[model samples]
Each structure stands twice: as C-alpha cells, then as structure tokens.
Target chain A: MRPILLSGHTRALTQVKYSKDGDIIFSVSKDQIICAWYAANGERLGTYHGHQGALWTVDVDPTTTLLASGAADNTIRLWDVKTGKLLKTWDFGTAIKRVEFSPDGTQLLGVTERRQGHLSTIVVYDIVLDVEAEQADEHSLRIVCEDSKATVAGFSYGSKYIISGHEDGSVTQWDAKTGELLDSAQIQEDDMQITDLQWSSDRTYFITASKDKTAKLVAANDLRVLKTYVADTPLNSAAITPVKDYVILGGGQAAMDVTTTSARQGKFEARFYHKIFEEEIGRVRGHFGPLNYVAVDPQGKSYASGGEDGYVRLHHFDRGYFDFLYEVEREAEQANL
Target chain B: MSKVAGRTDWAEEEDEDSLALPPPQITKNKDGTETIVSYRIDENGKKVKTTRRIRKTVMKQVVNPRVAERKHWSKFGEEKGKPVGPQSDTTSIAENIVFRPSSNWKTNQSEEKNPIDKQKATLKDAKIKCRICSGEHWTSKCPFKDTMAPEGENAGAGAGTGAEEESAAPGLGPSNSSYVPPHLRGKSGVTGERMGGGKFGQERDDLATLRVTNVSEFAEEQDLRDMFTRFGHVTRVFLAKDRETGRAKGFAFVSYADRTDAARACEKMDGYGFHHLILRVEFAKKPTT
Candidate 1:
C-alpha cells in the first residue's frame, strides 16, 4: 500500500485522527493549529484556532460531530466538526497530554500532568448529560497512579473498560462505570514508557507501542502477551486494521530535541506486519521525521499517520495487498513441502 | 584484270607526274611472264629501279636470354653466406630496426618515473587540501573524523556544550556543532545526516482522485452512485456526455466523500460487469490548468 501525503503544518505533529465516519481528518501539531481536512481529497476544510499553546492530541467522537483537542495550555477544548466552533472547554490546571472520547461518545477522557506535583491523572468526564458539570474533580472519575505517569489511554470497543498505559511500562484496566481498577500488568521491560495503545477491531486484543523498541499485542481479558513486534528504533505509535489482520507500526530514529531535525535517525515510514504470524508484510514510506501517531479509518480501508516532520499521510490498501497475502501463504506452504 | 591494272598504272602515272617521280609499268611477254618497273627519288635525289621477283627464300631468327638467365641465377643463388641467399622478409627488417633493440630498454629505464609515480608527483605538486579540516590530506583521512560521526556517539560531548551554544546559534546550531568538531568549523549551516523515506513525498500529494473510465454508456449518475455507495459515502458523480446530443459518453467520474472509499470503489468496481459492459475505475488526475 502506498500512502498519500497531506502537508500543511509547519511544526512537529503530535496527533492525527480520522473521524468515526471517515469523512473528515483532524490533526494537531506543535504549531498550535488544529486542521480539519476532507478525508477524500485532503482539502483544508477549516482550522480550529483557539488554543494558546501547542496542541498535543485530538480525538473525534463516533458520530464525527464533536472533536476534542488537548493542549499544553492546560485545557481541553471541544469543537464542532462541521461548524468549526468551540463548543466547550475544561481547564485542567495542567498540561494535557492526551484526550479521547469513549466509544459510546458519552464520556471524554483526558490525561493531564500536574505542574506542581509532576503527577499524571486520567480524568473521565460525562459529556452526554451535563455541559457545565461540576469540574472533573467532582463529576468525573479520576484515576491517578502514585508514581508512574499515564502516557496514553483508550476505551474498550464495548465501552466496558478503560485501559490506561503508564510511563513505567505498566498497563491498567479500569471499569468504565465504577472507576475500579480491574487488572494491571507490566507489559514492557526496562521501565520504558508506553507511547501509544491501539485496540483491535473485535476488542479481543490490544497493542501497546513503547519506547523500548517493541510493540506487544496482548489479549484483552487476561492481558497475556500474544505477539511482539520488534524494531531497531523505538516505536511511538501502532494501529490495527478494523477488518484485516494487519498492524502498522510507526517510529524513526529518536530525535535529540523537539525542534531540531539534526539528530534524528531511522527512516520515517509505516511498517506493516501480519497480525497472526507477526511477520513483516510491507512498509509505506513518507514523513521526513519520526512518526508520532497513526490511526486507521473506521472502514479499515485506509489509515492516516502524523509525524515530527509536521505532515500527515493517508494510505489506502490496494487490491494487490490481499493477493500478496495469499502469495505469501503459498510461498510458506511451498517451504513446508 | 588487265583493265584494272591499266587503271592502276594510269593513277600511278598521274601521282608521279604531280611529284616529279617515276611510274611503274607492266609488260606482257610472249611466254606469259610479266615484268614491272618503277622509279622513285632517293635521299640523294637519285632514281632507283625496282624489280618484283616471283620466287624468294625467307629466313628469320628470334633470340631471348631472360629465361636462361633466371634458371642460371636460381641454380646458384642458394649458397650460404651469400647476399642473395634467403633474403630477409619486410617484417624482420622492421623488427630489427624498431622492436628488438627496445625490447629490454624498458627494464633499463628509470622505474621511479612510471605512470603511477608521475600521477603522484602531479598530485603532490597540486597540494590538494581536505574539505573537512583544510589540511594537506583527504577529507576521509581528516583527524577530526570522529567528531563527524552520528549524534549517538557524541551525545555526551554534545550535551556538555549544548547549553552554552544553544543561545548563540538558533535552529540546528547546537545539534550540528556537536557533530562537527573545531577543526571543521569553517563551513556553517551544515544541516544533518539525511533521513530516508520515499522521495516522492517531498512535494507530490498522495493519490486521492481516481479517474474512472470504461463506464457503461447507459449507466446514469444514480446507478453509479448506487453501485459505489457501498464502498463509501458518495459525494458527487459526473458522467461525460455529448454536448449537443446529450447522450452518455461511455465514461463517468464517481467521487467519494472519503479517499478510502474512492480507493475501495476503484478496487472493487473496476472491471465490474454492468449491463453487459465491464466498468473501469481508477484514480483521477488533478486538472492541469
């Protein structure tokens, strides 16, 4: 699969997401601009421009109506996707690292770092009922680990559990409604930070990409490691196709500083692997810098990735990809014979 | 025959009368013997008489000595130590004059002035300097080579000087300076090591538009939309038609609301059979204008 490149941002990109309906693409960058593009042609539809600092992450609801963006300005702002208007904002009193909506679109999850204590907390607010709900401290379920900071989080496919990944290589599963910690596991060694987490379409398994140069796919119920995708460089983000048994991992040689491109290593491309065999299938090359995020569209036909180079790329699987899988299988069978 | 001879005699007499010379006369004798006499002026202006003889004896001798001389020479020329014995071919003469004397000359010549030595001498005279360290050596052999290594190797050194140089140089100053050492500090603005990716992503946008051809001539916009909506949301459909006739032009454009849908529709509906016509679908190129 060859990727289509989208260019607009001038600074490193932090997050890129496709709307649930797959009609719009939302990307946030360190340049402090949130751009919404038409998913079909990559035409700039509108820009959401209210953030005072660099935006860190963005997530779209299942209906593709509301877009939630978190920024270093210590606030999470929700915008209307169609009208490009700011709908609501929550002051978290700290820098927000990531913000995402529940699969049901009823709650919004934001991971923020307290400036004074240097502690990270996962705050889930009920968005469906109360617009001016008492601050997240009162109405939301706040989950904070004592020492480890949360890096990434996502809701389960059924909205029954919320999985939060920590900087200390630990992953914890919490009950969505009761805010109870159901299970936790150390999925990575060496205290490597988890960069991103992605759930498989069926919710049977989820993969966590870490700074340890590996991405591990684990069974959701027991959190047992299924397969490990290793790379020479740290993997920052990974995504699984909604229907197909394929996973795409994105990273590059680590950047020494956030601003300069002089100290980066490795090529910036999305590496694809067979979900079952864990064998590398193909790679899609783009992005001039390390990739930070990759999100597959809901239909499983295409995926989008953003990187430190500030460009977002959309890749579509061609008919030949399916045929290539069969050809690989035949080659494997011939080897067996 | 007598008349012809009389005519010849008259013509000869006429010529002799004009030149003041003698004319020939033929007379028949009683025994059937004929005698002819003619007179002409000689170089000393004397008249000479000529008589024709009926019977004469002729004798001729031819002498040629070249063949015999060749035989004599061939029989004696093979003697040893003689100049004519086994003459040297042209190649032997040329080899004696040119190659034989010089065969060992190269060995006696100066070995230090060979082609490679001359080339080295010219290079030494030119005094080439290294681009990196500006020394009298190649850049590859520059002493500061370790400083130009990748950032990971020099990370400790870079971190030490990073703070002091951070404010002085903007952009990639600290990062670039850390990799480049003091001896190689003349040229500035050295970007960094080149990262790898497909070069096509430099400026060209990914394939978002698909130009679909081979559409059924009878296919309408709604039919196209109905067939393609299964892949993704249909945004617009443009079917080519004759300007005046208002008839289908055998092709159409079906754009999707999402690029993934357009790609999916192109994959599935291309070569799709519709109303006995196989449809061809592909990404459309951007309009050049």
Candidate 2:
C-alpha cells in the first residue's frame, strides 16, 4: 500500500476542499496561506499568500476554476483557481466568519460577525458584473444576516439561505434571496449555547450541535425537533453527510468535563477516529480529535477532514470493520510455503 | 444551400427583436450552383429582387506515394523514402473547409440583379414594403423592427426548416457516448501479481491437489484457475475455482476479510499468476466503496 503524508502547512489547516473536478485539493491554514495539491499524488501545486489574517475557510467553484476565501480580518478574497491570481477582495469591515460561492458561481456570499453591534451581515456581490464595473462609487447590496448574540456559524445549501447559531442557545434561518426570516428555533432551554448547524442535502432537514452535548435533527419546514442524539459530551462541531445518511458530531475534552458533572457521569473520550453509525446506514467515521471541518467528496465514496490536531485525514468507507483494541496473533512457521 | 431552423428553450431565450429573417426562396443555376435571391414586394404584389449567384467547382483528386510506399515498399520496383507528388489521392474532408470561394459574380451577371444592381436600387426608385410588417416603408426605417414578427407568421413560415438545421460544427463526433478508437486499446497483458481471495481454514472436498513437477505444469494449473474464476467474483489469486458450483472452491479460497483488503491484494497481484501456474483473480463479493 502507498502511504502519502500531506504535511506542509506551518500551522493548523482550518479548511480543505476537493476541487470541483476532484483532481486537486485546496487547503487553508490558520497560518494565512492557501495551498493546492494533487489529490492523487499529494504533490503540492502552489500556495497563495495574500490574506493578512487567519484563513478561516475556503471554497471553490463547481468548475474548479475559481476560489474564494474568508479571513478573520473580515475580508473575502477571490482567486483564479488555475493561475493563483488574485481577482478581487471584498471587505466586510468586521470579523468575517464564513464565505461561500453560489451554486451557479455568479454570486459570492460573505458572512461576518459585527464588531460593534449584535447583528451580522451577509454581503452579496455580483462578482461577474461588479468586477468589470470597478468604479469610484458603485454600491452593492448588503443584507443583514440573521443577527445573533453569538457567532453565525453556518449557511445553507445552494447559497439560498443562511442559518445562524448563537451563544444565546437559538438558531435562526433566513431567506437568502429576499432577506426574510424563514424560521427560528430555540435550540437550548434558555441557557444552552449552539455551536454549529448544518442542513441535510434535500434541504428539508437540518441538525444542530450545541454545548448542551447533543445533536438534534429538526424539520426545516416547521422547525420541529425530529430526533435527538445526546453525545452527553460537549460537542465541538457536527456535520450531516450530504447523502443524508448520518450525523457526525465532534466531542472535545471540555464537552467531556461538562457531561461528567451530570448524573450519568461518564468520562467521554474524544471519539476522534471514525465510527460507523448503524442508524445511518452509510454514516462513516470522522477523523481523530475535535474535527474543525468535515467535507465529503462529491462522489460520496470518501471524505476529507481537519481537526484541532492540525492534521487532515481522508476516510474511505468500506464494508468491513476494524477492531482497534484487538490484536491478531500471527503464526509464522508452516504457512510460509 | 438552404437555411435550416430549429426550436429549443435556449434559442427562444435570445432577443428576437434584433434577428432578421431570410428570404423565402433561393435560386440554383444550370451547373448545380446555388444563389441567394432576396426581394421586396410592393402593396400591389409586384416584386423587386436582388440576387447573388454562387460558383461551384470540383477539386481534382491525387494519389499519395507515402501511403503507397508503406504498402508496397517490399516490392522489387518500389521507390523507398521518396516524397509523394502534389496530386495525392488521399484527402480528408477537414482539408476542404479552408478553401475560400472567389467572388466573380459581379462581372459575370450581365442581365441578372447583382450586388451593383441591388445597391443602385435606392429607397426613392422603388416603393419597397417592410419585409417584416409588409408596410409601405422599406425595412431600414420600419418602426416595428424592434418587435418580433407576429407569432402565427413565425410558426407557419419556418416549419420545414427544422430538420435540416446546420450549426457551426463543434468539430467531429457527437459530444456524448463516443467510444475510444480501437488501435489505442491496450494490447499489453495484465501485469504484476495475481489477485487472490482470503484464506479459509476449511478445505474443499472436490478439489484435487496434485504435486507440481515443472514450469509447464504450473502454467497449466494457472490456466485452470483462470478458467474457473471467470464464473464469479474471484476472491483469491492463489486459489483455483470449483468447476461444478462455479464458486471459489474452498481449497484455493483466498479470503480477504473485507473488500478493501481484497482490492489492495488485486492491485498488488494484478499480473503475476502463481509462480508456476498462470493465475486468474476474482472478487469474492462486490466492493463496498
């Protein structure tokens, strides 16, 4: 077997995404650098260094020819994926958390947390038209994203909606097209803080991972809780696989400490390695450590994940199981024919 | 020679106001040459037309000596490595598209309505009706130029043109479902090690294991396994298949506890049959990922 070690980024890689064509993998580091590498050979293609702040997230267009990145300095930079040329940068004037390209690639949505006010804003830019219309005074539409007391952690599929989770233990979904409130749910019982939220592929369901040590799947149409799985540990991040099979939750030591104080006191180990969920037929295991970001391949055969450990692992789903605790006894003599 | 039409949702999406429709009927000369004849009809149905005749000529064919040399170089009188003549017989359709047709219609048309005649006929000499709205004014100053032709007129006028529609070709072959050329197909044999299934503890009752004497005997054993595994997923490259159940006979059963192990084994042992026997590989079951 050929083992490839992908170790180049100086610091923790916060985000990594396979190019739309699946030929290359783009990784962003907290070191403020974006690197592209061959997905098969792990050969480094090139590194883009322009962001002044930590590169928090990166996304590529469906054609894999364009790239967008969001930084903690509240700026979103666009780049040509093939040439690594900086096309333009949009400033949000606050700490930007997440940025995403629309499914059609014509629009860019940049979400930022407000430094002064309680509200966050989703800045929408018509990249194709505005880039050519670069004038002294051209006004672009900036919609007020679901304002939360905490950070706005997630956006929805196709760039059609935004779902914001807050420190106040509530989640709000907004209509991305018209900036209207679609639905809101009180995730925590007035005291629980939500950490992250994700939408299922069909856009009909969504799940939230919170400080309450539970991940809950709720109906998007009515905002009703469909089912809940209590990790009984502090959940750092949660992601539902695009195929709608399983919900993966990342548990950390802090979550373990909180769960240990409850009546069912169990020292929750950070289930860092991958695990298969029987309830979700194809629910594959995630990486080891509190996963910072998890993204599945478009083909759904494998997934790339990054964690707090500053490492990324590619998981290939197979039918057989591996017993981590079991050791195989080897008999060496007569079998060597 | 004729304008073809087609209908699709994207075609309808184009701005209709800017597009101009072609004339009803064009003319072809005695020598199989065709020409475009655009006309304007007055309110009384009298027509004033402008025509541009196109010229046609057949290109001469040539015989290529390089292809002939490749075919007959072994012959006694064949000239080897010599350049072929200009009149090479073999030519492809792609070479013909580059030839530009010369414009000689201006001088050849004596009584015919050529470009000069068409240009000379100004707005004052003839009361030309609008081609689209068929009003009293000529098309150059028609106000309805900004609007599409009436829907009923459009639907009825171009029904026959749909089948023969021609587009600027995106080059040869359909964009979808094209097969690779046969010559490019690999002739190389399966290389590397042979894929084998996992090992099972229990041996098969039907398989008869014989002592290997020479390389020829090993090759024959390998052939036997290849023939047997053809029936199902070959689990092991090491084991031969059972002739009766068409299954991996337990004697040669190489068990990969999982599909990943089996796939890895297959990749490693792809070409190498057994050392003496030619080996065939099969998956015990379908792969999971």
Candidate 3:
C-alpha cells in the first residue's frame, strides 16, 4: 500500500499510533499537543493539549479507553480518550523516554532516563485502580540496568516478560512480576544505540531498529538473532506487519544541519522490506525531514508514521496489495510443482 | 794594576756624564776583543749614565744577507688541440630571463607540422566571394543581401526557388534574425505559442492556482482550504473525488487571491509529508479550452 499525506503538527512529531480497532490514529508532537484523527478520513477528531513540555512517546490500550503519554516534562499522564480529559499524572522524576500499556491494561510500563545517573529505569505501575485512585506507587516495580540507558521498552505478549532496548545496544529481558533480570544480550555490534524495539503479533520474535544501520528480528525465547534488514541510514523506528511478511523501517541522515543539496537526498521515507528474503520491496517518500517513528496498526490494514518534519501520515493498504502478494505466492507454488 | 785603576776611573767618570753625547763607538783590539760605549740621561735630566762593555769574542751578524736562486727546468714538447681551460656551458642571461613556452603551445606546434597541415593551409587560403553582393566574404556573412542566397548558379533561380532553398537550410531565414521586425517577418501570425506553449504549459495571468497532489483520499475540500488559507486568502479549493467511490482521488487544485500567495503556499506545503503521504505542490496549468 502507498502512503498519503495528513499534515497538521507545527513542530517535530515524536510518535504516532493506532487505536485498538485501527479506526483512530493518535499522534504526539514536540509542540506539546496530542491529536486524534479518524483513520478512515483525515479529520482532526480532538487534541489533548495539557502537557507543559514536548511529548516524547504515546500509546493506547487494548480497550481504546485510556491513552498513556510520556513527555520531556518528567511526567507521564493518562487521559480518557473519548473525552480528552486528563485522568491521572505521575511525576516520573526524569524525562520519560517511552511508555506502553501492558497487554491486559492492568499495568503501565514506563522507561525514564535517570535524573542523576547515566542509566534509565523501567517502572511498571499497578494501574488496576479505578479512575479515582491517587496512590499509584503502592505496587510499582522499578528495574534499573547499570551502565546503560534504556532507549525504548515494551511488554512481551500476555505480559509474561518486559524487554528494554538500551543505548549500549543491548536488549535485556526481565521477569515482569518479580522485577528480576532474566537474560540480556547485545543485539547490535559496536555499541550502537537501539532506537526502537517492537514485538511481532505472535510474540515469538521481536524486531529492533538501531543506529548501526540494521534492524534485526530476534527470537524471543533465546534472544538469538534470526534475520537482519540492512539499510544505508540509521533506522530510528521499525514495525512488522501483523499478517504479512513485511518490515517497515524509517530513518534519515544523522544530522539535520546538512547542506540543502545533501538534505534533499536524505532517505527520510519509510522503506518496506520482505521479512523472509530481506529484500527491500517498496518505499514511501513524503517527509522532507527525518522520520522518527513508524507504527503499523493492529489489524495491519493501515499504518501511521511521524517524523522530524512535524507530520503524522496515515497510510492505508489498498486491496490490490494483498492480491499482488497472493499472485506471487501462487506463482512460486506453481514453479515448485 | 794600572789598567784596573784606569777602569775604576772611567766608571767614576760615567756616573757624572750628561745627556749630550756623540754616537756610540766600537773598537776591535789586537786581542780580538771589541769594546763599545753609549750614554743616556737620567729621569731628572741632570746626570748621564754611560754603559761600556768589552769581551774577547768574534763579531756575528743576527740577520743573513744571502739570496736563494731557483733551479732551471728541462725543456718539454707541447701537445696540440687541447682545450686551454674548462669552457663554461651555463645558459646565457638572456635565455634564463625568457619564460619557457607552455606544453599546450608545444603540442599545437607539433600538431601543425603533420601531413594534414598542407591541406588545412590550402583550405584556409581559399576564400569565397558572394555572387549576390559581389563581396569578398562568403555569402552567409554578407550583410548587403536582403535574403540569404544559395551557393553559385543555384542563386540564378528565381526568388521562389531561392526562398525554398533558404527554408531547407534551417536558421538561415531573415525571420530568425533578431534584427528582423516582427511585423515584416514571414508567417508573422500569432499562434499563442509564446504565451502558453512551454514545458509547464499555459498559465493563467489572473487567478493564481496551485496543483496539489498526494492528498489523503479522506481529505475534504474544507480541510484543504483551511490548510492553504493560512498563507493567503484562498479563493477556491477543488478536491478531485472518485465518481463511483465518492472518495477523494488524492489531488486538488487550490486558488489564491494573489500569485505571490499561491507561490508562498507552494513553497510551504510542497513535499509536506502529511498523514503518511508526501504532498506535491506546483503552479497549476491553465486548461487548453
């Protein structure tokens, strides 16, 4: 599927995600605004504008009722999606880098760069209380890995484990309930920072994008490197389609202060790679700046991407794309016969 | 005993001597002894000290007076045709002051001396005289001729044939010349080619419009207008929608009140990656009809 333009942000976009049903898109930007739009149409449904600083990350729960956002203001705020009302706020005591909801929506996972240390701490809060409860730290667990700052983190499927991507190019797995370090392995060479980590729908493998100019699909059980997708630029974010064997990568030139002649040649578009052969299938070019995040929707019908240009684009896959895939598969089957 | 007494007398006389005295005298005695006497005044200038000495010894000169002579050399025969000395091979001052020719000049000179040089020289010397104007230069460079003429007897043909010949050779017509007046040129009819016939196509002189592409299929006319109106007073927005599906076809044409506003909008919105698409914005071409 090809991408379409949907511009509105006045500053750089930090993250974009789709609601549980894939009918709504949520995007946050450095302009201190969180906006919601209808996935089928480019209509601005509502904007949540209470943050005092630029938002760094955002995520939506499975029920699509609560939205969690982390910001550079050293706070994580929960909002009621339908009403655009701030439900709760927690002073994380550091600039939060990433936030995610546990699969069951019973817990919230947040990674914050430590205020006085070079490391980041992943905190899982027991958020099962009703909307009125104020004490969120009663049953929270803080897991800190020494000598490395976590760049991105996510909960494994069914909340069985928590995996955090670190600036030291390592991916560490932790026991979610006990806050114990289960296993850790270097996912990228040369100490390249891990920019993002996303799990496949089946949870058997998770994909990581790094500054080392490669994205790897790693087996979750043993942390073994399964497949690597190489590119010419540092990948800031990556996503795997839920049903198809496709991986989408987004990145551009390292620095933005390049000459206008060189800046125009930046690979700021989202590139699609075949998950099996690692061949680049297609590219969607629209952003004149670096792409910061790419998120495929729950059903894989559409995907949302945000970039340094302060734009959030929602691309929908056409029916012809799936038909083309089926034709290729059939031709391969015939050739084998 | 008398001689000793005489010497003592002389010593006593020398102590009372004055500064005024003759040159010193030396005498050779029979016993081969030489005696000399000299006088000098004291520091007070009132008394003179006389010094006298006698010894039995032969006189000797401190400096020798003999001259040494060189020995004669044997006669030898001379050899012929030998260089008198090493002759200088240094470059002259004039040659050193002159700058060396560049490599390009040397190459050109070498190339000119090849076998083709004779033919090239002959061709350059062969000049053409124009038949129409009887000028010494070629007909093409002749300014007196009203129309360009063909070579030699071909010019003898009437004006119609001459015109055909001129037309066959492109860019030789008077109409192509910048000096030719627009009204006097052949085929002077206005084809509206200059106004609208370039690569970007004809542009409307009044209404400034922009062709916007890569629009979201879900975008509405109002959304595009709202987005573009920030640059200027947007006069109209036309989102092309599919007839059967009733969805946006992913393109639109936006018009502004002023051309400058349209240009500003294009600069700001072109290549704007929005909603998963990169937008393309440029000046819209006017319809042919």
> Can you tell me the DockQ of model 1?
0.00
> Which consecutive 10 residues in model 3 chain B have the weakest lDDT in total?
B66-75
Residue A140 accuracy (lDDT) in model 2:
49
The full ranking of all candidates by lDDT, starting with the best, is 3, 1, 2
Ten contiguous residues with the weakest lDDT in model 2 chain B? B188-197
Q: TM-score of model 3's chain A, to 2 decimals?
A: 0.93
Q: In model 1, what is the error at residue A260, expressed in angstroms?
A: 9.7
In model 1, the Cα lDDT at residue A240 comes to: 83
- lDDT for each residue of candidate 1 in B97-207, tens digit (9 for 90 to 100): 111112122335456336788898787678645543233456677544443322223222323323323322222443543555544444332222212221211111113
- Residue-wise lDDT of candidate 3 within B83-200, one digit each (tens)? 3221122101111111121214334645755567789888878766565434356666654244323333222232433323232223223433344454444433222322223322
Q: After superposition, how far is residue A236 of candidate 1 from its true place, in Å?
A: 0.8
The clash count for each model shown is 10, 36, 11
Compose the digit string of candidate 2's lDDT tens values, residues B1-289: 1233444544664434224434547777788888878766556755556787878788663424432232221211111232432111111111111111112322342346355666777634665555543444566665434432321222112223221112201211132124434443222111000112222211110011111112232233355346434433332223333334444433233433233444454454444455544434444333222
Runs of candidate 3 exceeding 4 Å displacement: A1-4, A115-118, A129-135, A258-264, A326-328, A331-337, B1-289
Q: Write the per-residue lDDT of candidate 2 for residues A1-337, one digit (tens) a residue.
A: 1123355466666777775445567778788878765554454556676899888888876666578899987778887665566777777668666666665666666667766653677666665623334422222445664445545444455666666667677877777677677887887656676766655655566777777877777666566878776664676556555432445566554523443453223322222222222122112232234556555555444455565555555554333321111111113323453
User: How would the candidate models be sorted by TM-score, starting from the highest?
Assistant: 3, 1, 2
In angstroms, the error of model 3 at A137 is: 3.8
